[model samples]
Target: MPGVEREPEGAGSARRSLAALLLSMGVSAAFAVAFIVVVGLDPGITFALLAALLVSAASAYRVLFGSPRRAGGITVGRTVMAGALATLVVFGAIQAIPHGRDHTNPPVVSEPAWDSPRTRELAAAACFLCHSNETRWPGYTNVAPVSWALTDHILTARDTFNFSAWEEFPTSARLIEAAIRDGRMPPWNFRLLHPEARLSAAEKEELIAGIRATLGG
Candidate 1:
């Protein structure tokens, strides 16, 4: 083994750098996705932001360092790492946005004189949460954006035909009956969480009939 010239260690170093670079980029992408999801952005926006992050980071890496055939992996790794940090910054910015945190339920003025206690009971189970002042705020209702949309919806529903306010006879009786008949009163989203609010065909008919009866229709 006297002066047998060995090939330099350049290729091995480059291979290791490439491996580390790929690992960093994969981790960055995962964090960006998780961050976007956990912050509660809808799928469309989340995907858009993710694509932007990856493309921008990739382009930046390519600009700073030439083709991967060279030792460009180090530059790629740095750019992806920066992208992950940028996602965290975006999360913080979203959290700082104001509005959609009100969790108060106003006092019940007077309830409707229902045709029967069963009618009131059914309404309580299915509709009163949003349509009355007796709303039971769940944990997610406290979160932003969701809270914003839900509160707005609740306010609008209450305005439509609030059992809490209780006028002489609600003009919404026909609309309410129609919605219940069509399986839209409680809403699928509401039933998803409160299974008790789920209505059967027979029960829907009963609710519709009772609402019409209550309104003297």
Candidate 2:
């Protein structure tokens, strides 16, 4: 250890390294923001980024500042074993939960009214743009950060209310009405890409009627 020579931070090298780091950080942050904006601009991407950063920072701190003795305690073998056991426990707990019971109730209509084929068609067309249970819109769902959030929204929305399985939701009418009235259902960014999904005044009315009929309102 005494003979080891530490590399000195030369002025030019230090400046170049700092500049490169700053540039990289700026580019990463910009990409993150742009990706999120392209998505719904909802709280999802921001929250996920915050969570990832926090976890990353914590891991970095542990790696950089933790005592060597403690670090040694977590040997590769022990780490693998711990990870395996944790995964097993998680899988077991998940298996114990009843199928579909882990999720919230699917959207439903209270009473059945005259079924409007138009409304069902429109809802299927619009909702599937983002909430498609089988296939999502091309290229949209694959982008990073944006994909992260969109994937979550898609899964949650599909679980709560999948238009493909429209008849299953119990409060389908109320959900449809709220989604239209609040202008939150179609998702603003989704409209930008697929204008067809954007609901017009007449379309919204028809959609509401359809939802009402389905729910027996």
Candidate 3:
């Protein structure tokens, strides 16, 4: 070929930017997926985590493509990346604590003499996972902090009133009736995750009435 003007070496930076941008996106996306898998659906903490992730991603984008001005001795981009890396390390280390990964469902020694089959069905559908021996642990319950929270909640619920262990039922029936009637049995967060626990007006009424009849309100 005839001698022609060669492209400048700086032109390679464009290709570098493109590759780095894709890598940034891939890393961010992978972190997001892993975060959810590890932390489950805690709205507050998740939102904060995502906000930091967004800031880190934005800073990375600016460094890769936009003009990243030096602020102090180091740039803000590196600071954010360092903070995020530290957070990941701390969370990763938390997994080794082994506090709440116990998915043990003790034997169903007894059960309440449910007023009717429908009552039992309703209870099982809405409240059993946390309040009974037959809990079907979800995937998030296998992780660390999320597992800890869920395990604590479930244990507390069972202690309060376990339908599967009705042999030791230790509360007044009025408490049960009030819990259902006041729309407090299924907390908002639980309903957010469990659609079946989102009872309709009629269903709630029926369940409430059934609990009273079964437990002697």
lDDT, model 3, position 140: 73
- List clash counts for every candidate, in order: 0, 12, 0
* TM values, all candidates: 0.61, 0.50, 0.66
Sort the predicted structures by lDDT, highest score first.
3, 1, 2
Best of the candidates, TM-score: 3
* Best-matching candidate per lDDT: 3
lDDT scores of the candidates, listed in order: 0.69, 0.56, 0.71
| Candidate 1 ranges with C-alpha deviation above 4 Å | 1-92
Which candidate, 1 or 3, has the higher lDDT? 3
Clashing pairs in 3: none
- How would you encode candidate 1's per-residue C-alpha lDDT over 23-55 as one tens digit per residue? 766876775555444443455655665666566
- Candidate 2 residues lying further than 4 Å off, grouped into runs, are 1-29, 40-114, 131-134, 143-146, 166-169
lDDT of 3 by residue, 1-217 (tens): 4575786555555555455556656766676665454334455555565566566555654564455333312343454565466556556766897878888899897888888999998888888998899999878788766787688778888999898888785556788777877777877667878899998989988888888788786
lDDT of 2 by residue, 63-143 (tens): 544642444322333333433444344434444434322223334433234386686578766776444344344553444
Off by over 4 Å in 3: 1-76
